[model samples]
Target: MNKAQEKPIALSIRNLVKTYGKVAAIDNVSLDIASGEFLSLLGPSGSGKSTILMAIAGFVTPDSGEILLNGQKIDALSPEKRQFGVVFQGYALFPHMSVRGNIAYPLKLRGIKGAELDAQVERTIDLVHLSALADRMPRQLSGGQQQRVALARALVFDPSVVLLDEPLSALDKKLRAELQFELRSLHQRLGTTFVNVTHDQEEAMTMSDRIVILRDGAVQQIGAPDSLYNRPSTRFVADFLGRANFLEGAVSSVNGTELKIDVKGIAVRHAKGKDAAAQGEKTLLALRPERIAVVSPDQAKTSLNRIDGSVQTSAFVGSQYVYVIDTPLGTIESQMPAFEAGPLRQPGAQVAVTWSPEAGVLVKDK
Candidate 1:
C-alpha cells in the first residue's frame, strides 16, 4: 500500500456543477486529491469523468463551485496559468517535429536558453525510456512509443500536477498493459500528483492508488481498489467493478452487524458483520460469482447459506468453469477452477450451491 503524505492538499473540488442549458452535464460533486498521489476518475462515456478532469485542468470552467490547488482558489485562472501538464486521449504529437523537438517545445516556450533546453529535452527522453528514439518523428514511432513521447513532452516542464485523459486508450491490449506498468513506475519515480481519467476498469485498477467511480454525472464511490472491489456501496458499482449476482430480499432481522434476509421462500442468514442491513427493509445482496461453490447433494455440511438447484448450463473457460444454476430464488452463477482430474457436472445435474455468510454483501436495491 502507498502511504499518503501529510502535506497540504493538492486539489479539492467542492459542489462542482456544469449545466448546459436544459441539461446538467455535471451535478453537485466534491472530491479531494492528495498530493503526490495517483488518482483515477473511472466511469462510462457521458458519466462526467472527463468533465471533472477538464475542470481540474482549467479547460472547462465550472458553472458553480471552486477549484482549489493547495487550498488556493484557481477557478478563474487560465489553463496556461494553472501550470498543470495535460495529455489528452489521442497522442496529440506534432507530426512535423521529432521526439527531441517535441519534448523541447515546452522548455522553449518558457524561454529556456540553449544549454538548458538541450539538457531538459535529454532528461525527459531518458525519463520516458525514449533516449534511442529522440530523433524519430511521431509518424515513424509505434502507437505505444508515440504515447510515451507525448507523456515525456508533458512532464518535461516538471509541472505540479499531470492530467492524463486516457493516454493508453489507443494502444493494443498487450501494449496497454505494458504502458500501465510503466506509468505506475513513473508515478513512483517522479512523485508527482497524477489525475487520470479512463473508462477501462482494468486500467483504473492497475494504475491508481485511489479510484473515483462516477455515473450519471455524480460520484458513485471513492476508495482504494481492493476496498471498492470487496465492498461496493451501490448496485451500479458492484456491477461495474466486476460481475455480481444480485439476490433480492427483504431484511428480516438486524443484530449488531449481522443480517437475516428473506429471499423467495427461504430465510438466508448473512454475516455482513460490519455491513449490516436495516431491519424490515428491502435490500439487494451482491454475491460475487467466484465466492460460490458447487457441492454434492449428499454432502449435508451445515453452512451459513445453501441453495439446492439444477445446473442449467456450464461452460469451461480454460482456467475456470462457469455454471448457471436454477435455484428456488433465481438463477445463480458460480465459478469453479477447472481441474484435469475430474469430470465436471453437465446440464440438468442437481447440485448444492453454498457460500459463507460474508460472501453476500448487502447493498442498495438501486
Candidate 2:
C-alpha cells in the first residue's frame, strides 16, 4: 500500500513464456511482485493470468524464462516445495473434514501433532473469525464461511505467499462484497504477499494494492487501481477495466501537456502525460461515464467538452441514472446521480453531456 518499490522483491518473473502446443498460454511476461503487497492479475478467460499464477505456484511448467523468489530461481521446484498457499474457487474443503480438521490438514502432513497442532489450528480459525463454526462440516457451512475455512487452511502453515484463484466467485453478491472487505482488512493486518487472479474488475480493484491487466497471454498495463482505471494505456484496458466512451480523433495541436484533437469535426481538449508526443498521429480518448454530467438543453453552457445529444435510453440504477445518448460522433453512455427534487433524464430527452479536459484520457487503440 505504501512504497513497495523500496521493499524486497518477493517474486520475479523474467521473459516468462508458455505454450500449449499451438496456443500460447503465457507470452513473454516480466513482472516483479513486491514483498507484503497485494497484486491482482485481472483479465477475461484464457488471458494467461491463471497460467502465470500456476507457473509461480509450480503447478505448470513454463516453456521458457525464469521465476525467482528472493532473487533465487525456483523454476525446477515442485508445487509442494514452493510452499505457496493456494485457495481455489471450489473452496476445496474435504467434505468429510470438519473445519478444525481442514485447517489442521497441512500441519498434520508436516508431522506436527498434539498441543502444537491444536494451538496452530485454533489460532488460524480465530484469524479468519471462524471460531463459532470450527466444529461445522463443509456441507453445513455457508459459502462465505466455507471460504473463510479455506483461507484459514491456506494460512495455517504460514506460507511466504498466498495465491487465490477467484476464491469469492462462488458466493452471492452480498457475500462476495463482505468477503472482499474482509480480504482487504486481512491483507493489511497480515502484511503477507497475495497474488490474486480474477475476471471481476471491481473485485480486483477493491482488494488489490496494484493490478496487472492481461490481454491474450500478455500484460497490457500494470499500475495502482486508480492509475489503471483513470489512465488506461490501451483501448482494450479502458473498455475492460470499466465502462468507457472512446472517441477517436486526429491530433490537431500539442502544447506541452495540453492537447487539442478533432473528433468527427468536434474538437475536444485532452490532458496529456509527460511522455505525450506530437507525432501528428490519430489517437483515441477514453471518457468515463461518471465524469460526464447531464445538463438540460436550456441551461447547458458552452464548455470545452459539451455535446448536445438525445438520450436514447435511460435506466434508474438505484443511486444513479445511466443513459445511452446518441450524438454525431457515436453512441455515448453517461451516468448522473439521482436527485430527489428533479425529473429523471428520460428517453428522447435533449441534454448536454459536459466534462472537463482532464476527464478525457489518451489511450492506445491497439
Candidate 3:
C-alpha cells in the first residue's frame, strides 16, 4: 500500500490562474493532492478558496496552467465528465424529494434503475445511517440528517474524489463539531480523496490530513495541521490560523545556535531558526499566547528573558484563566489552566512574565 501510495499523484493543480475582468480570483495556485488523502483549502471570505475549488470542479475556466487527475489533463473536461462528487454549502436537495429519492438522485442520473438502483439506494441509506428516515421529506429532516442526505447523495454515484464546500457551516457549534468527526470517519471508510473548503480553522485542523492556506488568490502554505500551526511560513498564516503574539525587535547578538534580540527596551533571547534574518536585522517573534506564563519571583530566575508587567485585564474561563499583561513589549496575553497549584493574578496586579527561549519563534519581520 505504501508503495502504491508513492506510485503516482492523484490530483495536480499546476499554476492554475483564473481572472475575472480586473480581478484575479485564483492567482497561480499549484498543489499535488495524494490518493485517498483529505485536503482542505482554508481562508477567510474573499480569499479565493472557493474560486480555486470551483476551478477544480470545472465550474471556472482558468486563464493558464493545467489540472491533472491521475496524470491525465482534466482542464478541458466538463463538470459532468469530471466524475467528481460535490457537496455544496447548502443541502441543495429537492424539497419534494424524499430522503431515499435525494440519495438516489445521482445514481438515477447515471441511468441506473430497477433492482440495481434499489440495491444502491438501500446501501447508501445504510451507509449514511439514514435507513429509518428514508421516507422522510427534506423539510421533515433535521439539519444534521439533511447533511447526511447530502453526503449520501454525493457518495451514491461512487466518484473516486469528493469535494465538500463548508458542508457543516449551517449547523450549531456543537453539531458542527460532531459532523466534522462524522465526515472524517466517512472518509476513512470510503478511502476516497476528499478536498474540502472552509474558513473554520478548527474544522480544517481537525478534519484534514493536510491544509492549504490561501490569501489574495494564492496559496501561502500547505502542510499538516500541526506543522502549519507550529511553524507558520508567514505572518499572515500565523495570525490567521490562530492567536499569536507579534514581538518586533532587532537582533543584537548572535552566539552559535542562540541569538539575542533587543525588543521594546528589553533584551529577549530566542533560538536561531532558518527564517531568522542576519544579525542586526529586524525580526518578529511569533509566540503563542498559551506558551507565556506568569511566573513567581522564586520560579527559576533567568537572565535570558524576563519582564515585569501589570495585568491589564483578566477573565476566568471554565477550564482556564486568560490574562493580558501590559509590558514594555506591548500587551502579551497568557493562559493558565484553572487546575494549577496556585492562585492566579488579579487585574491591575504586578506579575512577572516569562517564557523559555524555545517558546518564542523568531521569523522575518512582517
- Model 2, span 1-366: residue lDDT tens: 547666899999999999998888999999999999999999999999999998999989999999999899999999988889999889899999999999999999889999999999999999999999999899999899999999999999988899998999999998899899999999999999999999999999999999999988999999999988988888899999999999998888888777888888998887776337474778888899998877787666767778899989988988988889988889999888887416777789888888888887888888
Question: Model 3 — which ten-residue stretch has the worst lDDT?
Answer: 1-10
Q: Model 2 lDDT vs. the true structure?
A: 0.90
Candidate 1, 82-140: lDDT as tens digits: 98999989978988999998888888888997888888889889999999999988989
User: Each candidate's lDDT (Cα)?
Assistant: 0.88, 0.90, 0.87
Better of 1 and 2 by TM-score: 2
Report the number of the highest-TM-score candidate. Answer: 2
Give the TM-scores of the predictions, in the order they appear. Answer: 0.93, 0.96, 0.94
**Greater-lDDT candidate between 2 and 3:** 2
lDDT of 3 by residue, 32-71 (tens): 8888889999999988999888888998889999999999
Clashing pairs in 2: none
What lDDT, from 0 to 1, does candidate 1 have?
0.88
Off by over 4 Å in 2: 273-279
